[model samples]
Target: MRTLPTPPLCGEPATVRIELYTADSLDACAYTCTGHVIHVTAVVARAGMDAHPVGMAPDVDRPCGYVHVFPTGTLADEPAELSHPRWCDRDECQRRDQHRSRARRVDTNRPEAFIVDVALVQALHPAAEPMVRLTSVQGGAAASLVLSVGQTRVLRYRLANLLDLAGARPNGGRWT
Candidate 1:
């Protein structure tokens, strides 16, 4: 129900372009979908990361990444079918009402469950490669593992790890 700003297109792949914007000092990422600019808060990675050889890599998997579209202004025009118990006079209720009004103002023609394309990348990794030095006369082989594309689950795991590392708590008092 929070108000967020529209992100301008900064960069994207062949199928999608990403625009980053800030609302209330929080960053939001937006992308184009079927000629409409849709705002997204988070891109959840569903596939796990794969280890690939530095020399030769295999083909990426399908549905390797899914664009989990959070509620956006474009998609806000339609009435929300899903509902939950809301506090009547609390600040949270006021915020929810504001979001509903904002969404009702936009003209989102598609249903609430439409899918959007998203790209995935590894956010964490070693920057410099480890040096392999030999002091003795014996010769040995050293290799480094590179990450593969279409590995969303790995990214999700990494995100969870980061949240834990930062001691972040889930909203609405829900914890897993």
Candidate 2:
């Protein structure tokens, strides 16, 4: 019912043999060269044993540097993002997480918290490219790729199947 931007895929999938993983960089940031990004989403994905992540997200106002008790939405504005990423949370971190772009939790404790963000990101990219990316951060790094809608779909489905094979539940449940 809602819409989420394509996750920001930030790096090259050089290690496709294992799992999609990489770090914070806009090198391979996902973009819709055609610029017609619609909304295809799976709002909440539970059904496994894991501690959901939570934080304030970030929003820097000036050069003094803005950190907080927790994270807030990213301060990296659409206009602020250049071809290169900074070493700060605003650029390297929150930007990749889609904090402001998707209204997603900068700290991303739960996906459900970002339902309202789904409808607010059609105009958030440079070069007239639709801001679409596919990335997931883990262990302080993210692996991104420039994939088509069909590729993303296949990847999502394949991951889902892998979970199924591993006996992980879906929607929200314990692994058996």
Candidate 3:
């Protein structure tokens, strides 16, 4: 039997453990369980543990690890999509997996950002400086600025300095 639970969202803390077992087939060996003359193929290698067939799912609703983890829905006896293969290496299933990848690629991509809806300044740690946390419209953290109370005045001065600079202009003047 295999079990794969949905992974937590980004930045959400979670701990997971997976067990690998090999069962014998009833036809070949006298066992009632449907195991194969073959055991589960070891795909990953860990330092202390034996090689195991385990991997993280790239995205939701997409298959990862074994082929049977997310099998194609069958109509009658054949594969559902004729163009795609019935096995684990099906192209149709692969297309469904197109999303943010867990593994790193050769090309570097920047982290996504959104419009900030809220800006909160709080001292998360008593001994530490204040933190200016920017929250996106979706409520996720867009960015954070750790600064002292004096640094906040500097920021305010910098913004006001821009207003002063713009005031020097004729059209975009003060109060207009």
Question: Model 1, residue 148: what's the lDDT?
Answer: 46
Per-candidate TM equals 0.18, 0.25, 0.25
Model 2, residue 74: C-alpha shift (Å): 24
Q: RMSD to the native, candidate 2? A: 24.1
lDDT of 2 at 81: 40
Which lDDT tens digits does candidate 3 get at residues 1-176?
Answer: 22322222233221222333223211110111113101222221121222232333334232222223213212112334334212223323332422111221222133434444323243212343333333343345444344555766788799788978877444444243
lDDT of 2 at 51: 17
Clashes of each: 5, 16, 0
Q: List the candidate 2 regions with Cα displacement exceeding 4 Å.
A: 1-100, 103-131, 136-143, 171-176
Each prediction's whole-model lDDT (CA): 0.31, 0.30, 0.31
Regions of model 1 farther than 4 Å from truth: 1-17, 25-28, 31-69, 72-87, 90-176
| CA lDDT for candidate 2 | 0.30
Q: Which ten residues in a row have the lowest lDDT in candidate 2?
A: 35-44
